[model samples]
Structure formats: structure tokens, C-alpha cells
Target: MTTASGGMTTEQLREHVATTLTRGRERTAALIEVEPDELTAQHSTLMSPLVWDYAHIGNQEELWLVRDVGGRDPVRQDIDQMYDAFLNTRASRVALPLLDPTEARDYVRTVRDKVFEVLERSPLAGRRLEEGGFAFGMVAQHEQQHAETMLATHQLRAGAAVLHAPRPPAAVVRLAPEVVVPAGEFVMGTSTEPWALDNERPAHTRNVDGFAIDTAPVTNGRWLQFLLDGGYDRPELWTTVGWAHRVQAGLTAPEFWQLDGDAWSRRAFGVLEPLVDDEPVVHVCFHEAQAYARWAGRRLPTEVEWEKAARHDPATGRSRRWPWGDEDPTAEHANLGQRHLRPAPVGAYPAGASALGVHQLAGDVWEWCDSGFTPHPGFEVFPYEEYSKVFFGGDYAVLRGGSFGTDEVAARGTFRNWDHPVRRQIFTGLRTARDLTAAERG
Candidate 1:
């Protein structure tokens, strides 16, 4: 059997389609507020009205995956009247009767189920492989896009006091200053394998002089030394832009971190807890990472350096889906899947180490790099143009790996995340690197 997304086998197409729907449902349930009269109040500038977004998601899925594919009409065809952003430009302007929260929820589920059934019943052969796959991939990515938007909306609506929870104490593990990357040239991006994102494309080769990266991400214990040395207090350690950001935000330490009677506590997810010495220091923005590196006599690695360290293959210069290998993520390999619901000790997953023996490259938290957000040579925008093109300015920094809350597919090694230096949320952190000359001097 084959699904409407003709490229994938019946099972593969079903899984992809189903997973997208599941994520939408999950995020909507988590973030949307229940209101009397089924009218969702807009609380956050980061989000559209909750009811509008909810209905919009379903309408989008139906339009792209069902109607665009020439499949049956959606179970709730009336949704197109009010929620279709493409068709209903005045949706917010007009006072439309909103779907009952229960009915809205069911509508999302019903559309997904009907789409799945259509795909399951479709014939395998003579399928429009490229077009169908593109349609499915677009909707899948669209839903993921909304997932992020909804998360931001939830945070805005709930306020910092309720949205950010504290993490549990992290286990301490000592780390060496450097892990050697043997001298070699490595393929730095995706090859002609499965679907490759545009930024990962035009897979290129580069020669990397051997160097060392910190064996684990810089930890709370290590960063504390930098802090005590008056790291943030000093202007020399900061870039001019960074210093300006510090003053504007009045950031004395990583966001959510506080000094409490000679000890440290940090606000995470929504609670406050004593700072754990061993966890990778998170909530630090790119500028903070840069400042800390300067103070510590180190620097952030370029994307090439990071990829060379991560994708090193002794023989055939190729990239691995993960730092370790092609195997899907498991809880034992990393602190992802919300298993611990917080960043674990940096060295907890020795198994997830990359080729150069860099640990936690796939999960726990995203590590900021020095590279500007630019396209790889010959890179073109994917179906979702907003994914990387809009953030090409130097204001954004490159972040590798996935965070505790990221889905497993998003955690793949080739996946790239970028954000502004001052916006710290969703488990951002950093590791450090030093020039070979400095390491030799030490």
C-alpha cells in the first residue's frame, strides 16, 4: 500500500502524517486555555488568539494534505469559513462563532484520522512521488512551526513566574580541558542520503587542522569561577555589543540564575532550585557565551570546526545522523525525551559522544557556536522559507544539538538551530574551545 505522500511507503507516510498531528494535538492541549463561551482570550503578543491558531492548524492540514492532494473534503469543512488564514484574512476582524473547545479538539483529531485513512487506502504504484512527499513534508514542518509558536505563546500568557520551572540537581562529573581531534579532512554536511534540509545540502568537504574542544559542555561549576573573577563585571571580556546587551537587560548572570545568601539558585521551567554544579550552564545567551569564553582565554568554534569535530570519520569522509551513529535517540544515550525534564549533568551520557569525543552533542541542551547564521555554499531555502532565510543577519548565532524538550528527529546532528544572542530560553548553553598554540602553552 502507498499513502498520498507517494514517495514514502505506506507505513512511513502514515508515521510522518500521524506524528505531525500528534504534536499539534499535544502542544494545543498543553498551551491553549479553556474559556467560557469558547472564545479564547489573547494574552500574549507572541501568539495569535488561541482559538484562531487551533482552528488555523486544522484548516492548514486539510488544505495542504487533503484538499491540495485531491483527497476527500475535511470532516469539518465549515472550519475553512472562519479559520483559513489564506482565505479568511478578516478572521480576527469579524466576530465569528468559535468552535466549542471540545468540538475544536475533536475536529483536529477527525481531520487527522480521515487523512490517515485516505493515505492507507491509496495505491502504492504510479504515485506522484515528489509532489506528494513535498505536500506531506510541508504540513509536517508547518505543524512543528506552530508548536514553537504555541510554546512561546504559552510562556507569554503564563508569565515567567509560572512558565519556567526549576530543574533537579545535576550529578557532578569532572571534565578535562580538551579532547583531541586527530588531524583529518571530513565531509561537513549531509550527503545524498534521505531528505536533506537545504542548509545541510551541497555537502561539502574541508580540511580541518587538528584541535581540542572541552570534553564536556562548560558546567555551572566552571562558569562560577568566571563569574567570581568578576567576568560579567569587567568590560574587557565583553564585545561592545555584548556589553550593551548586559546593560540593557541588567543581566548579572545567566537568565533565571540568582545569588541567594552565598549560594546559587536558578529558575527553570517554573520552579526555583539550588544551582547544580555539574549541569551544563544553560540559559546563557550567545553574547554571554562569547564573554565567558573571552574571560576564560577560549573562544567559540566556527560551524566548520564544530562539524569537523562532530562528523569526523577516519576513512570515508561522511556525516553520521547523530554524534555517535545512525541509531535513533534513546534515554540512556542522552538527557532528552523529557525523561528527566531538565538538563542533566554534562557528562551523564558518555555514549552520545561525537567523533572527537565531545559529549552531549545531541541532547541535554543546545550549545552556541561563534559562526554567524549563514547558508552553506549553494544553499537554497527549503519549502518553509522562514526556517533559516529570515535569520541570516549576524545578530543570530548558531546552536547545535537539541534541548531536553526537542523532538528526537530535530536532534539529528545535521539539524541547525539559531537564535538572537539576548533571547535565552529552551535550554541554551555553551562549551568552550582554545587554539592549539594556547593548549600547547598550557
Candidate 2:
């Protein structure tokens, strides 16, 4: 093994690649370990069957690592289009000649074994994709992303509680209602991250005027107040598009929430429990979050503002890799990697706070930003264009920070996630921000 790109030796890169792949597999197993094969069937039209995602993960590894990177013969060339996401829609995928659960497990195992063999021999430095071991990292991140998708399907599936984990730690610090971020220029994306995908590339300087953003995400308790105040009923609080969508969808509260008499409860992985006041609200769509921000006389932060708050260190005037620092995330930093079933209570993970005093910026729930999805200044299509180039438009709203379901490999300060604004199935939430008054900025 020798040094290649990103200043890391091939041995170090290989370890990282192996560790990431192993963790992704472990997570996939945990999500489906006890569920019967029938449970893996198409649970929602919005998402592919668990079995499809299962084999797709393996298929991608075989395509990229085993075949492309290693120059090996195809393992299952017949099923290439069967698992091609661009070729098949999620709703229609159930009708495809998909692999059974047993077959899926075996196929993934076989592909992974081949991958390991290739990984050991490859220099991981020659081609563009091999530079910095990007392909390996990309595949690992892809699997983790699918794992999170599977977790979402599990949440949508109806059943008694099948998943359990310890509750996130209680809040250790009391944060202010809002923090003022002075007007300034900050780097918004990543140019140096070896594993960062195309949309996050070509880091650029962005100048944002002074604004005051919520110290933490909007909480369920505050949302309860909005609901009680007829927030949904008040069309004035919602944009014309949002109000129309709300009416059509009949969205009265966050997904999984249930009301009984005077109290509210939420369903988590099949268990119904009283909603906690302090935990950040999850499963809310961009429309819901935007409406709530409007009702509160604020708005969701732009993607740039979100990144600045999560990465900027005031003293050094530089962006840190994460809110806590450039160091890799640990359990102490934030709630991530399915370590918990839900978001941590607000004010938790004070150690995860950025230099500007922001908290929970790394994980908990995906926070919706006001910005629409687009490319950076110097964006270019890489290994493939379908991964991000197809989604570069205003149709998709951006979300920053990872969720409790997100793995560290797929979550970083500069990482970008975007989806249709009406989507609520993802683990999504929001934190509000407002422009500073003249006196305040002065």
C-alpha cells in the first residue's frame, strides 16, 4: 500500500473503506434481522421494497468495485436493469423480477466477498474515481444511505414495536432562544473532502447578511402550541403553494402524531408514546416547517446559513469539518448511526456545538433549509451524472445535517440532501432564522 490522493496512505484508506462497509452491513442487518420475509415486501409506494434496496446495495458494489474498479467479470449481468434506479420507478419496482430475501442476503454476501478480494489487490490510486479511494467511500456512503431509507420504511410499516434502543441523553445545557450570526463571508461547500459527492464540490465563498437563527431546532412542545392555536387552519400562516398542499394533503400535524382528548402521542417504530416537549420535531415536511416558521414570524435558514452555523469557528475565521471539530464524530458528539430511535432532547450534545454556539447541528433530524437545490459555482459531473445532476433544480428543497438514522460516512458538514418539499417520510425537521434589525447588526 502506498500514498495516493488526500494525503492518506492506501492502508489508512483501506481501513476506512472496510470499516464503513462493515458498519453499513451491520446496520442493514439490525433493521431486518427479526422481521419476516413478508415484512420486507413493498411497504410503501413511495419507496422500493426492502428486498429491492437490499440487493441493489450489493448490485451497486458489484458494478462499481468488483467490475469497474477491479476489472472483473459481472456477477449478475442479467439483473443490471432490474436494479437500475433510473430505469425503474419505486412504485413499479415491486413488479420487477426481484430477488427474494434469502437470495438477496446471499447475493450481497457473495458480492461483498469479491469486493474484499478486489480491495486488497487494488492500489486505490490510479484512476480518477480511485483517487483518494473515492469509489470505495462512495459505495459505502451509498449503502448507508439505503440503510437509512430502509429505516424509514420500517417506520412506515405497521406492527408492534420491533426496534428498540436507549433514549437519547437529556439536555445538559440551557441554550438561548436565538443566536445572532454576524454578517460575513464563509465557505459554503467542500473542495478538500475526499469523499464528498459532486453537488457539494467546488467550495465557494458566500456572503450572508446578519441574521439570528434559532439556537436549536423547533421542538414538539412549541409545535403543540402552534397546533393548539389553529396553525394549520390559518391559511395566512402558510404560503399559497403550501396552503394548497396542506389542504389537499390534510396535514394537521407532524407524521405519526395522534391526538386523544387533551394529550398528544407519537408513534415510533410501532410504539405509541406521549410526545416529549423538548425533542426536535421529526417527520415534518418542508411545507409544514415553512408554515410553522411563518407562524412564528421567522423562516427556515438557507442552506448556506445552516452550513455556516454548523462549520464556522469565529476565533479562527475558518470552517471546521463538523460542528464539534474536524475530528470524526463519536457517541458523545451527537445522536447518529441509529444509536437511538429518535432525536435527542434539545440542548443535548453541548459538546457538538459549533464555535458560534449552535447545538445538535450534526445529527438528531435532517433540518430543512429555505434554499432550493442547485450546483455550486464550479460543479461538474463526475463518475456519473444521474447521482445529482438530474436533481439540480428548484423543485427540490435542501436539508442539512444528518438524522439519527444517518451514518457518519454519509453525513458531514458539507454533505447535501434534497427532496421534494412534500416529502414527510424522511426524518426531517427545521430550525428558524430571521434577518437582524439595523440596531442589532450595528
Candidate 3:
């Protein structure tokens, strides 16, 4: 099994750290000229001040992983006292000394240099270096997370013009209406795999019955049909919780889409664009997804069903990391890393389809599931205390797959992400499933 840094060769560790640092530097350079005042000009629910967030990324890595645990001191030690999210209210506005954007960039570079020097000087053959390797892993992941957050900040700060919309593929591929999954026992959640997050641990076996899942995610056109059919207007289609959520938000349609006369258009990035009829519907909340599924005579897959279908079955030659196989993600294969910065037409990446013939299972937009955020049995918290435990009973729902902004590591199948049911800011959407017995036969 691949360990985070435990079993890695010193050369491997050096290469990983160098590559991660290069990525971080590139992301930092991208936002150096973004006007700070412009970033804070609007009350965007989707973003924070670009400069502030940029500094916070470095501060978090240095404070939490290096200084706090690695027994090193921060170059700007006062940052620890000022920007610690655990100590300061995340939502409360506070006046504090902040570096100019350029200064912040310099500080990050200085920290990176120090980290690189330390790694270079460390003795390779010992547990001490291994501990350093682990610390580097933590820092690398911390920066990866900030990379995603920074992308969101960029979209909000630079407006829609800066974020490119994905062009429709030259040809559209319509998937089979449904794929039938046979009833059987399958191992649910992560096993003794290499480097799984805490939430995916304590893998257990689960028994499931035959079910039919949509071959592709629900599309904007399909969801619009539901909306026009009074899907949201009818209370019968919504759960009690869902109805309340819809009422509170006063949502008549997906957050980004609107009906102009008889034509449908949506706010792409920050500008209005004609809705691509075949693109997978995105930015819809889980409540909306649930209601739409109910209206369409289907349901969201339980986490077990999703996992079983997306992963491979040992007995059936179906075991693969992604739906397509154990290959690394490529630009042509999945809509991720802001490659197109917009949701693509469903089934655009036939190469990314899962074992059950499900398309876009790993990337495009994050798909909401029917499961709540809870620990698997024998689950142990990771060293990062608040990552999972803080949100266990919160009003959040589980979203699988990574979105356009998600990094390759976070986009792993075992990675679990959750947000409140009302969050529609992120690139979130859904697919539907139905019990075989309840499926409307053609």
C-alpha cells in the first residue's frame, strides 16, 4: 500500500515537494495583480478577498504543519496570532495588519525556500526524515485545498469574463437510459488502501439489491423539464426538509439559470450565456436535486450503491480507480482543474465512464448523494482535528466526485466532501437512481 511519505524514497519525496511547490507558486502568481478592493467590493457568497486568502494559504501551512508540529518558527511569527481560523471567528470581520499582495507573495516564497532548504539538509536515513516527509504531505495537501479556494476567489474577483466556458464537444454521446446493477454483497468504503482520508476508513461489507442508475448526470434540459412541470411548485415531490429549504430560498429554478421569454439562459461564471441543452446541470443544491429526482420517478443512490458502481468488482474484472480504469486523470478524460472552468455536456468524457457504464462519475461537477455525513464504524479522526468531526451532525449532505476546481488528489474516489444543503455556490449537481422494481419499464 502507498504510504503518505513513510515508504517513499528520499528522491521521490523531493520530487513531490518540488512539484507541489511549483504548482502553488504558479497559482500565487496568477492572482498577484488582482485588486484587493475589487475583490471585497461585492458580497459574493462564493469568494473571499483574493489577497487575504492568498496569504492565509501560506499562513495555514506554515503555522499548522511546520511551526506548530515541525518545531520550526514562522518567518512572520505574528501571523500565527492573527489569522488562525480556530482562534478567530471565520465569519466575523476584524481589522488586522495584512501584507500588501506583493509582500504576501514574497513571504510565501521565503517560507518555501526555508522548507526546501530543510528538506535538502535533512538526513535521509531515519525516522526524523520520515516525520519531515509526513509534515510535507500535510503542507502539500493544505496548499492543494487553497488552490481550489483560490480558483473560486478568482472567478468572483475577475468576474465571468476571466473564467472560460466549456465549448460543447463536437459530438454528443447519449448514454443508455439506465444501467442495471445486480444485487450482491460489496465492500463499502475504503479498505487498506494507500493513503485514504479518515472518513473513508473502516471498510465494511454491505448487501444491496438490484437498482438502476442513470447512465449520465441529470442535464439542464431534463431538469428544466421538471421545473416546467411544476416540480418545485408541487409539494408532493419534495420531502418535508426539502420543501422547507425551497421555501426559504424562494428558488424557482437552478441558481444560475433563468427563463428569458421562452429561451433558457444561465449566468456562466459571472455573465449570462445561453444554456447548453446537453451540459450536465450544475450549481443546483441537494434539495433541488432530491426534489427533481422525486419528480422524475427516481431517487439518489445511497453511498453504498454509488461506491459499488463506481469502483471495480474483483470477481467481474471491474476494479478500477476511476470509472474508466486505474489511470491518472487527463484533460481529455475529465473536466477538472478549471480546464474549461465550466460544466461540460454530459457524456463528453466516455473514457471516464465507470464499470456500470456510468459517465462522468469522477469529474465534471460534484454529484450529491442520498447519504448523510457520518463516520464509518471504527473511524478514527485524522491528525487534522476539525476536518471531519466538526461537520458530522451539521446540515450537510455528501457529494461524491471532484468538480472542475478540485485537485487530482482531492478528486480521488475515496475523498469525501460535504456542504450544507443550501450551498449552491460550488460546482455541484446530481445524478439519479431507482430500484429495479420501481423503474418504469420501457
Candidate 4:
């Protein structure tokens, strides 16, 4: 049976959609101002031309809300062909007949206006979005996700940084090496989160063995040790496929780093500076994370282990929505929502610690887990399968925790982010774990 999470009214949902939609628009507008030419430029094959993102957001709103739910006429049926992501490759998108920036903005405005009308008329109580105002929440989160993607394009773009957000505060204290999570059964995923996407649905029990995980993310200084120790040159430390790719890509360091003689620096946004020693390492692929763990005599946590460490309250046998409990995230909880341009230092947020005292489980960076992307036992695709189902069972790795680019409204301890094992442009990081047995040891 599909049931809705309680405690929110339709009016509250309405206002939330209005507010969040505006925020996404403001961010998108500010991003285009970086350099009009850059927005149209395809910075990398990994991302679409900026103008495509602009129109695609509006087109999605039209497809899901105005036309699909409201039974309204299409806003710009002709242009839908040009913006379909599944049909158009990122490389191919740049040459498509995309709308100009001015036309794109107008399209987004018109679609949002129609969507608000649909929200007003629809009874948000029968199914899907109606079941829990989920559609509205989904739309808001979608736009925010795109905004983060656009920020990635900005990072890859050549020019002065168009994006500007304060860096998170420095770490003030040291982290304990690891936190021990006692073995037991714990609930995973959720059936009650109003805005949860389909892949995270149908909360269920999972039995995880006892393990110890890092109390904080691996810092740049700590990762530097792996590099200095020749971790990359040792094929024995990396998987055969990973070793092959490492040599192919010339993977000496994280994506944005540059080694100069005896010194090291990395590019953040538009400027290059010496690496912050205490900050969590970002932009590392899973292969690199796996290699570092081997060098350090540890391992990456499995996705289930990752969740139990971050969510299981042994005292109550219940999971928290976030590391700090059932409450939603705030500025004090973690570094998120693009509020910062970079990860905070390793031990930055004591207040955000999990029940077991594991810190930084909520944000700063999305931590890679040692699991491939898959589905829950009772999974059912809602809205569409393309969002999550299509990506299942691929050569993808699951990443837990949100990132500095993550919008808190879209993040929860149960939330999931997945990508190819070789992706490094994302705000990705790692925290080492180890099995509580001898044979598992390397």
C-alpha cells in the first residue's frame, strides 16, 4: 500500500514549492552572468551546453507538472525534441537547436507559472505527488540537482570563476581514528519520507556485521601520504581495471590538483591556491579511494555498513533522518546547499555527528561506498524508471552523504547518489573502514 508521510499541509507544500523554485531560478540566473559565451560553451563532454540546461529544466517542469498532471496543452511541444536528455548525448546537445538564453528564461518562467496553477487545482492526496505533495518536492529537488551540475560546469570552464560561495570554516579539533558500530539489524531506506525518490523507497531491515569506520573524512594531508608512498604506481593496490584506467588517464592526483616541484596546489572555482591541508579531499574517483584505503591498511565501507554507521541508533534500534536526529539540516548541522564552495576541514561539525559519534555523515562531501548501485527488495518505480531504475546494475558506485553542493532539502541519511566508478568532477570524498575480522584484512 502506498502511504503518505504525515505532518505537512497542502498550503505548506505550496509555499515550499514557490520558495524553492524561486531559489533555483535565482541561482541559475546568477550562473549565466559568469560569461554569456561560457554558458553556451561546452566546457567538457561530461556536461551539456549551459543553454541546454536552461531550457531542459523548464521542459521537465512542463512534462511532469503542467501537461502530465494538469492535462494542459504543451508549452513548447516543438522544442521538447531538442531537450530530451536520454535521446541527446552531451556532446551532441551542443549542436542541437537549443533555445537562446533569453528564450530559455522566458520558457522557464512560463512553465513555472503553469505549474503553480496545476498545484492549486490538484488535490494532493490520492497518488504520487497527490499522495504526499511528492511531485512538487521532486521538482524542487530536480532543479537544485541541475544547479549543482551547472556549478560543476563552472568549475570546468576556463575563465574567472562565475560562482562564488564562502569556504566552510576550518577544522578546530582532531578526529578519533574510527568509531565502532556494533553488529545488528537496522532499518534502511524509507517509506515515510515525503520527497524521497523511488530508489530510496520501501524502508526495510538490513543485518550488518560489526565494523569500524572513519570518524571523519580523509583529509588532503592524509591523502597526500598515499601519493608520497607511491600508492598509484603499485598495481597490487588497485583493481586490474582500475590500474588500467589509472595509467590511461595518467591519474597521479585528484582531478583539480597540480604538483609543482615539491609543492602542491589545486584549483577551486576560478583560482588556484595551495591545497588546504586539513580539508577533506574532493574530486577523487572510487578507484583512487579504493587504492588509498589499501595503502592505509583499511577499506571503504559497504553501502549498508555506511548507513548503519551513519543512521543506526543502537540504543533505540531506529534510524535518524540525518546524523543529528530527525531534524532537517541547517547551517549548524553541516556544510551544504552550495552555501560553501568547498569542504570544511576534517573535524569541522561536532554537532552533526551520528548517534555513534561519527561526524560529517551528512555533508561537506559525498562519501563513496564500496557497493554498486542497486535497488531495495520491494522497489517500485514511481514517476518514472529513468530517474533511478535505468542506472541500476551498471558499473556505478553508490555515494552516501551529501556534498557542499547538495541542497539540504534534497538530502537525508537515506538519500543516495551514484555514478560511474571513474567520475571525479563531482564533490566526492572518502572515509576508510575495516572489517572486524582477520581474513578480511589486507
Number of the top candidate by lDDT? 2
The TM-scores, one per candidate, come to 0.80, 0.97, 0.88, 0.96
Q: How much is 228 displaced in model 2, in angstroms?
A: 0.4
Which residue pairs clash within candidate 2?
none
Candidate that would win on TM-score: 2
**Of models 2 and 4, which has the larger lDDT?**
2
Kindly list the per-residue Cα lDDT of model 4 for residues 218-285, writing each as its tens digit.
99999899999998899999989899999999999999999888999999888999999888999999
- Which of the two, 1 or 2, has more TM-score? 2
Comparing 1 and 3 on lDDT, the stronger one: 3
For candidate 3, the C-alpha RMSD (Å) to the true structure equals 3.3
User: What is the lDDT for 297 in model 4?
Assistant: 94
Off by over 4 Å in 2: 1-7
Which ranges of candidate 4 are over 4 A from the true structure? 1-5, 437-442
How high is the lDDT of residue 365 in model 2? 94
lDDT of candidate 3 at residue 10, scale 0 to 100 = 74
- Across 1-442, the per-residue lDDT of candidate 3 in tens digits comes to 1334445677876676567567766755664455656533333644555556667777876765456544587688877666565665534422456676667778877777777766675543355323535455556656666677666555544353554555535325767878888887766666543445668886777778888888888888898899889988999999898899899889899876878899889876567878777888888899999999999989999877887778756456434556666666787677776566677787688877776777888777888999899888888886665768888877888999888777665676667888888888778889899987655332
lDDT of 2 by residue, 134-170 (tens): 8988999999999999899989888787888999999
lDDT (CA) for every model shown? Answer: 0.68, 0.90, 0.71, 0.86
Which of the two candidates, 2 or 3, achieves a greater TM-score against the reference?
A: 2
| TM-score, prediction 4 | 0.96
